[model samples]
Target: MAQPQPIPGTTIFDGIQAAKGYALNKMCFSFNDAGNRAAFKADEEGYMARFQLTAPQAEAIRKRDVLGLLAAGGNVYYLAKFAGILGLDVQDLGAAQTGMSKQDFKAMLVRANEQVIH
Candidate 1:
């Protein structure tokens, strides 16, 4: 059987990625709790240490680099919690991922919505 072609600019969150992202995703999941979010805000380094995040994962979290987080195996769903802690929404993440200005990304979404509605 022929191997499936990988999608360009897309990372597949397979079993390996799930294992790799376990720590990071777990930490993000903790953000569901207000106290946990406050604790992370209070001591970013200490909180990451508690989660045992890898060097790259730690750096990505510190930098708030969405693409880097994804490359490090972060799932968008879990990352949403992290983004919430940073006062960002899914549209912000979409803009960052697409390399588009937030305004442009929002405009694109509006256009896409219009196409479907009309």
Candidate 2:
């Protein structure tokens, strides 16, 4: 059998990633609560310490590096909560993931939608 080709510029969220990101995901999930979001904003370092995040995960969070967080095994679903805490939305993440400016990313989305609709 031929070996499967991995998708370029994509991280497969498999068992290894799940295991590696358990702590980070858990911390992000906590952001679903308004109080938790406020707490994180008030004491970023202390909140991350409370979650016992790995060094890379903590650093990614500190830097607001969406791609780095994904590379460090963060699930986009969970990370959305974290993003919301930082006043970001899915469009911001999409732009970051594609390395496009927000305006360009939105334009691309419109173009793609037009293709599908027409």
Q: Give the number of the best model, judged by lDDT.
A: 1
Residue pairs with colliding backbones in model 1 are none
Measured with C-alpha atoms, the lDDT of residue 62 in candidate 2 is: 89
List, residue by residue over 48-114, the lDDT tens digit for candidate 2: 9998999999999989999999988899999999999888899999899889998999999999999
| lDDT of the candidates, in the order given | 0.93, 0.92
Per-model tally of clashing residue pairs? 0, 0
lDDT of 1 at 7: 76
Instruction: Summarize candidate 1's per-residue lDDT along 6-52 as a digit string, tens digits.
Output: 77887778778899999999999999999999999999999999999
TM-score of 1: 0.90
Candidate 1 ranges with C-alpha deviation above 4 Å: 1-4
All candidates' TM-scores?
A: 0.90, 0.91
Off by over 4 Å in 2: 1-4
Alpha-carbon shift of residue 40 in model 2 (angstroms)? 0.6
Q: TM-score for model 2?
A: 0.91
